[model samples]
Target: MVLWVFGYGSLIWKAGFRYEERLVGFINGYSRVFYQGSTDHRGTPDYPGRTVTLEPSHGEVCWGVAYKVSGEEDEQIALSYLEVREKQYDTKVYLDFFTDPNTTTPAVSGVMVYIGSPNKKLNPNYLGPASLEEIAEQIINAEGPSGPNRDYIFQLENALLEIGCEDKHVMDLANAVRKTLSEMKMDS
Candidate 1:
């Protein structure tokens, strides 16, 4: 059985695991939101970076890439890699599809997704929901061992566009960040 992993955020640009194949796909009944906070990869505990989380929204689809792992061993390796990378999320096996626009093959199913719940007590970085301006402010001021929070947003925006996916929320946040940075430069 092929193991499929769905990536809607950083994994689109920075999937550290090896995969046999990848396809553009979307998971239905869920919407992507920057409601999850990042205290490790993107920011420190004192100032966390906003990251995407899959929230249930009927009739909505979250577009992303699905990576296919070949065998049992690779599946284990991929799972292990994702465990460290996506430690903040709660894993779930979803019946989703990975579609290739140019292929005659039908969409693939049984894709696994990582989701973070706002009410989950284990996730200290879970910031739940916030206004766009509030998120942008935190992102603009956050810098962690990985890099600046702005860089993460910029890269994810670029990656989404490149993959033929448009996320208005992410793009809007990116724009806000840019505007805030410009204002800060002028003030300084």
Candidate 2:
């Protein structure tokens, strides 16, 4: 059996796992938003960095990459890695990805997607929704073991653009963060 993983955020650029193949795909009925907070990878508990989450939105589609993990052993290994990397999210199987945006074909079925829940009881770092300015402020001033939160947003935006995908939400947040950083540099 083969395992398929759907990546819409950092996983799109930094998979950190082995995959037999990758395909650019679009998942409908969901929208990506910077609503999840990261305390381990991008920020500390006191100053969590903002991250993307799949929010339910009818008629909305999120473009991302789908990784195919072959063999049972590799699937297990991939799952283990994702469990740690996506500890803040709940894994769900989604079959709405179309490898070709123009067609209704699925590159891989039963694709596992990491979804963030905004329940404080479930995830202490969950920071629901915030304005772009607010998110930029937090991202610019946040850093963790992985690196600066600003880097994450920049990388994701670049990756999406590289794949010929244009996400206004991501671009807007990225632009805001850049503007904030530029102003800070000028002030210093």
lDDT of 1 by residue, 60-86 (tens): 778899888998898899989889889
Query: Which model scores highest in TM-score?
Result: 2
Which residue pairs of candidate 1 clash?
none
lDDT score at residue 9, model 1, on the 0-100 scale: 92
> Local distance difference test, per candidate?
0.85, 0.89
User: In model 2, what are the clashing residue pairs, if there are any?
Assistant: none
The runs of at least 3 residues in candidate 2 whose Cα sits more than 4 Å from the true structure, single-residue gaps closed, are none
Per-residue accuracy of model 2 over 1-188 as CA lDDT, tens digit each: 88889999999999998999999988888999998899999998889998999888998899999999999888889999999999988536566568776777776767889988767787666788888899999999999999999999999999999999989999999999999989999999
Error in Å for residue 128 of model 1? 1.6
Candidate 2 Cα deviation (angstroms), residue 2: 0.5
Q: Mind sharing the TM-score for model 2?
A: 0.96
Worst window of 10 by summed lDDT in candidate 2: 90-99
